[model samples]
Target: MRKIAYSLAMVLLLAACNSESTDKSTAEVQTKQEVVHMEEALLGKWRGMIEIPQSPLEIILNLKELSGSISVPAQGISDFAFESIKYNESDVAITINLGGSLIKIAGKLKNETIEGTFTQNGQSYTITLKAYTETPVTYEKLLIPVAGGELKAALEMPDKGTGELVIIHAGSGPTNKDGNTIGAGSNNSLKMIAENLAEKGIASIRFDKRGIGDNTALIKKEENLTFDLYVEDVKAIVDYAKKDDRFNEIHLLGHSEGALIMTVAAQQNDVASLISIAGIGRPADEVLMEQLSASLPPNLLVESEKALQQLKAGKKVETVSGQLQSLFRPSVQPYMISWLKYDPQHEISNVNVPIIILQGKKDIQVTEKDAENLYAANNHATVHYFDKMNHVLKDVEGDRDQNLASYYNPDLPLTNGLIEEITKFIKQ
Candidate 1:
């Protein structure tokens, strides 16, 4: 009787263990099914608008089963992959690293819509997304070979060929081919210019310089970048355009720092003409010093002036203040030193082609005097001033607050007559 009882207890223990295993397997399958269902609901293209101040910018999110990417058409950003994406049955969180800036989105999945708060650099904005379909691409992507690597560029050709191509170079910093900086949001000024030119039956090419946008891999070290390197890059683009049989006449258009680069590049390349938009006429060091004068304290201002002088002399300062690190950082000092060597006034005078100088009277960064200085230097240059236009080439009729607000407004049209003047210049 004791042996039979022991055998029955063993059998019961085995049955209990098998039952537990079966239950665990069922739970695992159910969990996987729930996850798959959530993914199915979340996958696809989502369209939304970021309710930024004064404007609503459209954004597109494309999700796969496990990964996703985003696009801002206004900013010319496409297929920028997400850094991290965490989602559950009811909620989703996304993080994107733009250069070094962080853009975070937290949303709740409600039926077919995803409503979220888009946060970047401490500013929060509302965004709502629904199912979307992507439009066909209108521009051609080109990789122009440079010294270190190739530049990622876009070519926008008009439907009607005009045999004229304008190469557009953006301003300094991390500004991309679309003229949008990472943290500054999308202004699409350059993109607008390109489209406007295309509408006028002119082809245009814009590019992401080294260490910016898709060309970030071009420069492994910031210290290696120089103003001369920028000029060479522009020359490379010019060379690329020259080789293309589609274009008979090649023109160069540069904004801000790009204006200086094109001025020097035009002297080297066989381009037809050059256009300078809101470019600094004075030495970059002088312009920078003037800009910092109002913002820095007396002591820091003095130090910054000294540092600028050293950089202008082709020397790097060994020690920089904590507050001034962004401007005087050692890695960027070499580029500054090379940039300081060029005087726009002197460089513009050397361009052997017809020159157009366009400036905005309301431009806070560059003054009307800058346009006048360039005109004074170049004998063949014609200058035009937009009375209501700001630095980003937008029409802002109100106070400084309104002027700044236009910088982030992609829908804001370029100042009236701005495109007409450019078209007239190119056609003439």
Candidate 2:
């Protein structure tokens, strides 16, 4: 069934985020209902489009619901699905239980037309799905420039309505547009979140990092890049969003390292709002040290301690040998150095814009303590602390190991509460 595959996709997406503390029982506890398949229930083939107001990039969703399966053509990496389809005659509404994610479609259903927002992953999308009579629609990728480099981004917006723009900055690795992962990496986790955000009335812009994808123009060579390069790319995206009339405001939603980028960009630009998802609250150096120390075995931790000493002493870590080399390579060394340079608490404190900080209690990367640190730094910012979310902003059972495993899956959708917090903040 398409629902089964889509469920698998979500499984992969969150697979990597799973670690020793991920818990799946909670998600499985969702209520179940049985319904008879009704031909008049508005089931079958449905057609819809994801529109971006500023650009011509539109994603076509040609979904087919048959028996118990749902197949999506653009299922590139994240296979979206509905576990069960239910219709209510009183309100002319439909409820689609997409895996653990739920979306309620409500609007006038007449002349073979249905319109409403699909609620998923915390955000709401303005959707209009029509019964398909022709071949499924094809999707085309949209390319845009960020930090003077070309980035592949997808957009979804209403034809003429000026909506809010949510620009999703990629996480710490080389990720693509669909959120499907590459290279020791997972699928486009951020992209999956962005697309789900599009289903909710918000337009999202997600792209490959500078040194990755078509963005190579901005990234001279991977070996020579630094943290500031990412900050500049965020600025470029913000600038582009500002010039586009399609959005009334720009929402900078950064995850993990991207959150640091957003913190930097907010200082330099005029952004409508800020959403720091699973971002570090302490200084990068401190967080790195914490993460390394927490994840590494005892022996490796001892060696890492020596490297940290070298770094703190202002000594080049290159002088270190053995396992230290991998920890302090030329490429990663500069980034670590540059990363250690900024104090997130200090930087976020300087941001005058409204900020919403979300952290997953089960996250192995940016822990709930990190979110608290950020919130503490800015006492006035809105903070939503969720106990069930992982670093990728997906709900997880508290088994840390299983949660990290979800990170590699590349099939799961982000946590449901992520977009909801963002939307609630924006609306406020």
Please, what are the lDDT tens digits per residue for candidate 2 over residues 1-428?
Answer: 12332233343234212312332231232323333433364654565532212111112232333322222222221223334344444123444444334555454455677666544454444656567554232223566565554665556553333388877776775555445333333544676666556667677777767654444345443356778877877777777677777777888888888888888888888888778888888776566677787577888777777776666555656665554454575556666666667788898998889898888778877778788889988865878878877775567784778887777666666777676777778767
Model 2 / residue 4 / CA error / Å = 39
Against the true structure, what is each candidate's TM-score? 0.78, 0.63
List the pairs of residues colliding in candidate 1. none
Per-residue lDDT of 204 in model 1: 97
Q: What are the lDDT scores of the predictions, listed in order?
A: 0.81, 0.60
User: Superposing every Cα of model 1 onto the true structure, what RMSD results?
Assistant: 14.5
TM-score of 2: 0.63
